[model samples]
Target: MPFIPHTEEEVQEMLVAIGAASIDELFDEIPENLKLTQLDAIPTALSEMEITQLMGKRSLQDGEPSCFIGAGAYDHHIPAAVWQLTTRGEFYTAYTPYQAEASQGTLQLLYEFQSMMVALTGMDASNASLYDGASALAEAVLMSVRANRKSKSKRVLMPRTVHPAYRRVVHNIVRNQQIELVEVAFDPKSGQTNLAVLEQYAGEDFAALVIPQPNFFGVLEDVDALTNWAHANGALAVGVVNPLALALLTPPGLWGEAGADICCGEGQPLGAPLASGGPYFGFLCCKIAQVRQMPGRIIGRTVDLDGKVGYSLTLQAREQHIRRSKATSNICTNQGLMVTAATIHMALLGSEGLERAAAASFQNTRHLVEVLTAIPGVEVMFEQPAFHERVVRLPAPAKGILRSLAAHNVLGGFDLSADYPELGNALLVCATEKRTEDEIAAYAQKLERVIQLQGGVTCGLVPKE
Candidate 1:
């Protein structure tokens, strides 16, 4: 029932009926310190029309800028029909397929999502989805510790080249699980994981080694060497990948003579957009033997009683569904809406279209690097081949230059100094297929102006930390 205003007589009668002298007496059991005296910070309620106008004005502040900033989340062009079809009442409002009989449509879509991810990663099987890329990687690490029979140690080797945010998430989630994470350094010159350092720890009693392809620096790693080394040492090779890059680069499953045991990555590049930070899904794929250890839910195809084809919820290892101790993961729900969009996108753009998109992104990124490095004080940090992102050493602090660029309505790349303080004045920039020649030219011109205005420091000299 809706709340209605009470008359003074009725209020007094209710107070008398409840044996309370005043409204304040109703809360006599509560402590004084726990009670709020006034709400000083909250503003007075505004009219609907007034609020609508205010919100609209603020929304305009997020207008499309010439975006180049891609640390992990990317700006990909999502088709209009993708969301329109995904957000239908049936798909958008559907809940988890707890009762498989009524959720055929949702289950079928997720099955398709799994099939596409498996083909892309060249893995044996894939789960429906997970929270996001960071948590997915964390879950994959936890799975390795349980599934790997050769090494019983709780130690995992993590490369510094992995996205710092992902590393932090892994630590935050698994730190209390008695897992030991050893940090491996990257080669300063090539911006790849230091193979010598990795080799040093390869023989250790580690359960898994986390390798990032087109690592956080955007430089491709020696996947073949790393995968072979990890497997030879009896540790599972966990590949943290960018799904789009798989179209052009080698898939994780084909990394070495053996193959990567597990693969996890952000699925945003496939179909999800950079909605500020996200609403993106994470995909996890692994060998068939490790399917039981995989987290979240997996949809499987089968035949009905009459021998007709159908889809249903298959593997669910969540604590909520199974015994707590036996559960492989505690992840509650998959990002269903995001997965729906991703599946539709992959279907729309078949294998050929995906490859073309990945190739174009690589070309655009190379062109962007060439233009940025043309400036007197700008220099590319790594000579190794990269995908869609590159580290460029800047004369001054990248944050300051980026701020200046923003005034020109350009979203420059991420400031590496924030996460990688050792990098000094480096900025990690990306150029996706969505970028145009005009946008790249404009970014170059604006960047050159910023460098000159800031009194271009010597080339190759980063400002001292």
Candidate 2:
């Protein structure tokens, strides 16, 4: 069927009503030079089966490469049951779940999700979900401003160690709001937040301090010291975290326990695929006092007339639909499906399973790091303990090294020099539970070979595969 809804006469009448002589007039705002002047080089139509086969073939090209890439998003294990249950028509097609009476299941799922996030983050309260990690951080910054009773200066202190894209999101969301963003630099030797430097910038004018747990370089920051510092300055401490790492590391709520006011993170590692970068969930959790300032919807458990349990959207004061300028945020959609999937995955794994997965990823990554650093020209960038990722300084240019590794069908880690110039020729490698020991060993061998090919030789050892 044609996608256009109007009949020819209806289209003509609509065009005439709009004072346009033809359909092309509707697109007059588009520059004439930019308009397509010729038909595409390929046929416009294909049989459904042909299209399917074509798509399948295109997808196969992705497998021709091995993926070792991780900056924020990771390739992790997803159980078959997660897909099977999520794909059902009842869950897959559902959205909003606005009609609480009709959306009990969805609301309950969101409630459970919120509950899980609260437990994972160690925060007093959690929202249903946000757009993704970056937006969540942005929202948390805004929430900090709202929580500061004495501050009108909308200044936020964010460390350079936080994900680069996340910092960009903060700029995008806060720029028009007249918020001032101050970037705190990391210690050159440690690759972690310089608390002394952060303290120098801390003041009454600042609304919040944003730090990433197991920051972009994969070094875990001292949350206790940082959170205390932020609080001492009367600023909220916001911890941007990786959800999977929470399985083994201290939860951000513990940061709250240490005095952080807000905690938020990317939930992508929790059963959400990279999907070429996103459509993942951003989770926000905070002290109960900041619930009114939270940016997204909240689902609460209630009771029915018969005294049975029920769930409904509650505490929606922050949403724009309810209050225009008074709204805490303009975000309306809750990222329902993605949040649901994460919630289901967490529930399926429970605490013990999640801990095991985290442990395996940690052990595997440590082993890989040991092997890679054994290469003469390669050195571990941060000797600090990491959760599932690490950074290595390469004797050769990182881009050249990555290209060489790619030739051998191994996707290399993110090159830090692309963003951190000081960390010259460094690559941030990540391994998850999904990576096998053989894969790790193969990666080390390939990296060694790539380094040697670049005319860089490792010290004190003969090459062995």
TM-score of each: 0.89, 0.89
Residue pairs with backbone atoms closer than 3 Å in model 2 (clashes): 121-253, 122-253, 132-282, 376-458, 376-459, 377-458
Where in model 2 is the C-alpha error above 4 Å? 2-45, 202-204, 256-258, 458-465
Task: Give lDDT tens digits, candidate 1, residues 103-197.
Answer: 99998989999999999999999999998999999999999999899999999999999999999999999999999889999999999999998
lDDT of each residue in 60-154, candidate 2, tens digit only: 87775656778998888887777688778888898788898899888888898989988888888898888899999999998888887766769
Clashing pairs in 1: none
Cα deviation at 437, candidate 1, in Å, is 0.9
Number of backbone-clashing residue pairs for each candidate, in the order shown: 0, 6
